[model samples]
Target: MSRFSLVRSAPAPTPAALAAPPPVAPPAARVESKPKSPARDAGLDLRLRLHAKLIEELDLAKLDKLDEAELRRQVLGQVTEFARIERMALNARELEALGASIYDEMVGLGPIEPLLKDDSINDILINGPYQVYIERRGELELTPIRFRDNDHLLRIVNRIVAAVGRRIDESQPMVDARLPDGSRVNAAIPPVAIDGCSVSIRKFSKKPLTLEKLVEFGAMTQSMSDFLYGAVRSRVSTVISGGTGSGKTTLLNALSSAISEGERLITIEDAAELQLQQPHVVRMETRPPNIEGKGEIRQRELVKNALRMRPDRVILGEVRSEEAFDMLQAMNTGHEGSMATIHSNNPREAISRLEQMVAMGGLNIGADAVRHQIAAAVGLVVQVMRLSDGKRKVTHVTEITGMEGQVVQMQDIFVFNRTHTGPDGEVFGEFRATGLRPRCLDEMIRRGIPYDTANFDPSKVLG
Candidate 1:
């Protein structure tokens, strides 16, 4: 038999094999059993032990002074050395992966670093130590990534919040923060989370999407984009309405690009995520109360304060509560190009939600007065929706003309008429112009904003 076949079907040790010298290990190489731990993968123990040893021996201060490339190289070298010293049976590829994981644990968010590095992943959802999910291309899928245990996951959660100067624990229970790249983060732990620690991250694109990019993605037609550009430049107050994860903020950001460079903009959010490209922009974020519950800053307060900042326009990240009242006030009282987003099914529902949120401010004004205020303030309601096929499109671009008594008058300028879903689950639809000329058209003309009147023709079907 051949030597390989002899080894595979060995009945007894060959005399030549028994006489060969044993393989030599590195001088410092040694193997030791790890202390017993619950919920940790058996494969993870060696890497964890090597990581701990590297941490114990590395010069952290010196490493921090090096640039990223050099830092990675030196850290990886140490990781490989420690892996060898611990007698790890890793091939070259496995060693490289181990080194990268250890490097990320040292300088990044540990287990989920790879997911964060993946630009295509739009969201990261951590249900617990053992379950992680990612939303890629608008559809959710489970991933193999996991923490060593619940404590490991909590350490990551705390690391995230602590970097942003926030706290999440039994006392606070929940917190909202943003990554350095402006991705929104929400975390809950322990008593409130029920299933260990849970974290939801809404990641934004590194390069923000513009209106033209949205057009290429079939989000809106060129005519709609033209109308929106004219509307924003002409100082039309607008509200973007959409359901959760339906691209409200994305549309708002794209629309903000239409504003003049000379205009000073102020943005407010629960966790600041808007990427307005204007030079003269001020961003504000709300704060949760301390453990004493005395230092909370709400969006309503920020909205009121933004008015004092002499802003040419106020761009609210969202109008979630009583802040809707203040936002409408800004839109009415000379902050004409101001914009905000709201959660609703359609343009009419968005109007109703605004009226309800205005009441939430505990104002003494009657409902008809509130409706009139909304009608006067918001010039357009751009409704966006994520369809069943995972594609987001502008479903409606309805204009608020005025109030017809207690009812606020509105007209659909552009509407997406869905025909059917294809066999491959793609939504088939056409964006149609209602042909009803918006009142804002006269204002756009008066402002000398160039736009084609034929864009509003009923027969003109847009993409």
Candidate 2:
């Protein structure tokens, strides 16, 4: 018999009980009744019990060998049997929901599984066991879902990292992991995260966003898109700069579609979130140290190793450290179409950040030489930003026109001019091209990559 027992239906009424008369009420008196305490959710408690029973009955050792379909079938069957044995009153819909919840807790990430399955949610932020928040349509809203406690929340985190052959605990209080569908996961616990275990999941779109889709979404104008397509096709090395949640990676992915299929591509990242559609591509991810605090592999090492892989282009997911020096070397060498993303406010700040990163490499090069290297290596700086209204736009399309002494000369080709905010809290901006034509237009024309000089006309509002 199972250890758990449920309240069974009352025994059929006996004949004597049916014959007995109703009891008389006592005389009226001012007897006070205490206020009832708040009741807990009975459904959550039921699901938790069912989850525990399911885990106890299943042969977990052979779970890995079973296909998802078969495992799901077995889980549903077992759940139905368990409910029937316990005499729990559950309808078809309720039974199915119970089965799904049990399955999620058994093989998925527990309480957050439903949130992860919701395509509408862009981000899942867990503040603690009691608080969960999701980002939808660019605004954050709290969800009713929660863990049982801190231990429950930590178990979910452990499951996530373990799937990717990683671990998280007090010794290594933070970790970066990815879901099966390529969503990025970052977790911190205990001493590192003061309140409780916190997890941030950045969900990627099921369908990869292309340049055309971005245009339709008003992320950029048709003219801006055309210019970027031409720039990428002409093998102009570019850098995408943006703040957090600013669609930098999305823009980078869209622009990468412009790359020729014939060229081999190599991508390096901290968590391997890029979804390149090219057949000839190699992806690399950085590794954190093991329990012994050894065997840590950083992005810089991967950047150096990618050089020997014979790539037509090297794509860094994001340059945050000394890898900027090696990335510059790749772009300055034969890898002309290489691209990467950076965290910055604007084009000017992006260049300055790159300079600082190169210096972080502990190289003997002077500041002037570093500026020249940046100017020669990066041809275009695509600045993206998330507006107050939660919409993302390409704020600047800047071209590095080489160096004049210590300064790297850059000119704005396309700019987003924010005029006003709408009554609905929407940001109203027009994407316009400056009157001065970009110097890269000549390079694009030389490469026969289909030029459109009209895109640079000052009178034109591109988007």
Candidate 3:
């Protein structure tokens, strides 16, 4: 500084020079931009573009490789980049949150969630995710709940099958399971499904349908309910018949509610859907095989076991197979008031189906023996049907009048007469009583029970 001052003594160093060179302008408060690398920027752009295209295609097969959280992150990032390029005014944080919520909703919801929520939907059919169908009032209709692809649909199907301890692969391509809500589920995949993966769920009520509810719904007249209650009280073995979705199990449950609370009831079924209110009721269900193909139990096995339980009545959910033989035997041998359901169009067909199922047991019994057992076991057959107008009604109530020759003679004590249909597409029918006067009624009267023949007058009741 002395040398500099000597050299420029003429001007004498200015106060500015002495004052730290005017503070050097404080470096202009520079904002440092993140250094951009051409190679890294290009690589990131390439990755984002590829991921955007993949997401646009909704390719579940490849998306499945990523975990749900990672997929959500990537999707949100791509969406943000897209909005930025389009000069849109979307809040980045809000868009990311929406994407995460949508992903969770689509992934977490089960395939049957929509159908279960729809009150009008009585049944749900999943012929893969792209081919969903539903039944409303006994009619089937297709829906549109498609998956991203076959892989996604299969993933859901596999999840359901695995949860139920069933397998639906190329080898065991078909499976029958039940939902947690007691809905019946059947699934098929790959070679068996043919049309990708398929699933069918027959939804059941979470609550048992009572007799009073059935009467309120006009499924049967109150007189019919009273008579059926009388029949149940009289210990008359009865059978209920109906086609699919005709409320067979619903009717069976209602009838079981009429059973005396003192009686020890034993109920057997393939899937255990019956809801009897009696405290003494014993419920039994069949078991499917494990993955090792061991520990299988059938309805017939349960029925055979129930015989040893000393049941006052054996209630079979539905006699669809050889279990009919054991059920019929139980009913014939002192198990009065025993009841079961069968798939049939009418009373005669119900008898025929029972005989055929009894023969399916692989026994050496002749058709005559089967008929005799059925006639003796089943004293009453009440056939219900879901009409075209979506009303369930008891179409026929027949009393088995014992065996005549090789056939079971049945007398129709009550019949449904279609009066007409109202403008609202409602069916109006009259449940008329036939004055045949069942032979079993006299026995009920003799047991000090009060059942008057005057109640059978159709003119007084069917107005």
Candidate 4:
């Protein structure tokens, strides 16, 4: 048996030590000395006897050896026996209701319950019953909550997997699921996790990130926002790239808000996170297979289908797989100004990562061909980063200048320069213009859009 069983079965404290009462008489005398009323006598005959019997049967040995299904079966059987012996009145529905209450009280709330109620806690990570963590306001911290034990945690894991129509056992032992609120969940048990069962939940926010909020947080200046608005309106295909938890999605959402309302937009994601204000928006999400291991719809498949929908722009939540190829093809065709995000350190590395992803699509194309496609497709790469001082900023806004030989060329149109740092480690950076306006800005001016070169000149504003 496990050590938990030994702890649970430890001897109880003596009555004198537990209370300030006098020494009790012998058990038989104490029982006979009690003043009995009709209600007390009847209640004792049923509930007290049932409680004693249950305590005897629920000893540590029986609990440690039983699987979840067997334990549940035993619990139901005991409930039925107690009801029948007491001649209590209950229908099937009432009995099931009682069973659920007892189960919750005995076993504890399952994995996702605590996470659902916590608005400040953005993420919940479970590394078995003994170790759990949560992310709050971009920082990860450990939590004191635990499952009943490893077996209890496993039972909750199994319920989640089964609800998603997936399976996780020794063979698979890993799965991804989404909660009813659309929070993303990934689980890996035993052998695979190596540190007992593990679960990671990325919480969903019902209210999407907005540009107004970004400005209030000092993530970017209003001039930068105005420039991006012009870029998106002029159909400059942009990619927002950043490291994990670096506000990539938030920036992407803010940028997409600049898209003209007349155009139809289609967004594809593993879990839908984008909040577009336009009325003509269609959202598509990927799906895992059923228990039969069929009917799975992947991101690549959705990307291809989005192409056929005659969309004005295609928005992908994140490009981590071979779907980057189709996304590039769509952009290279007529879908200019289409936007998505990728994981990369800087704008230059974002292009390299896109090229690598295109190669993974099983295409036999040369690197030169891939670079050409990327250059012609992606017009701008906006790199966002969260610095050590807990400030998120747009580190680089780079424009693709086209391909030179086999290499893709990019020019930084806007860059953040750290002007000063105080003794408290707070950074002060200025977003400065590089004097190289995008080639498409001329097109925007020709299309009757007003242009003020003075606003684009950072020196004029700084002075």
Instruction: Tell me, by lDDT, which candidate is best.
Output: 2
**Per-residue lDDT for 1-463 in model 1, tens only?**
1122111232433334323343434333223532222354655554555555556556555765778887777767765655555556789898788888887777788889999989999999998777889999888999878877677788888888888778888888889999999999999987887667889999999888999999999999999999998999899999999999999999998998999999999999998899998999999999888888879999999999999999999999999899998898999899998999999999999999998998998989999889988999999999999999889999999999997868998999999999998998988999999989888888899999888888788886775
> 136-190, model 2: which lDDT tens digit per residue?
9899999878776577799889999998889998899999999988899999998
Measured with C-alpha atoms, the lDDT of residue 212 in candidate 4 is 74
CA lDDT of each candidate?
A: 0.84, 0.86, 0.73, 0.75
In candidate 4, stretches whose alpha carbon ends up further than 4 angstroms from where it belongs are 1-115, 155-167, 289-295, 419-427, 446-451, 458-463
TM-score of the candidate numbered 2?
A: 0.91
Per residue, candidate 3 scores C-alpha lDDT tens digits across 121-233 of 77887765456778887678877455544565777677766665667777677777766666777778877765567777777777877888888887887777777777877
The model with the greater TM-score, 1 or 3, is 1
What's the best-to-worst order under lDDT? 2, 1, 4, 3
Query: What's the lDDT of the predicted structure labeled candidate 4?
Result: 0.75
lDDT of 3 at 44: 25
Best by TM-score: 2
TM-score of each: 0.89, 0.91, 0.73, 0.71
Candidate 1 Cα lDDT to native: 0.84
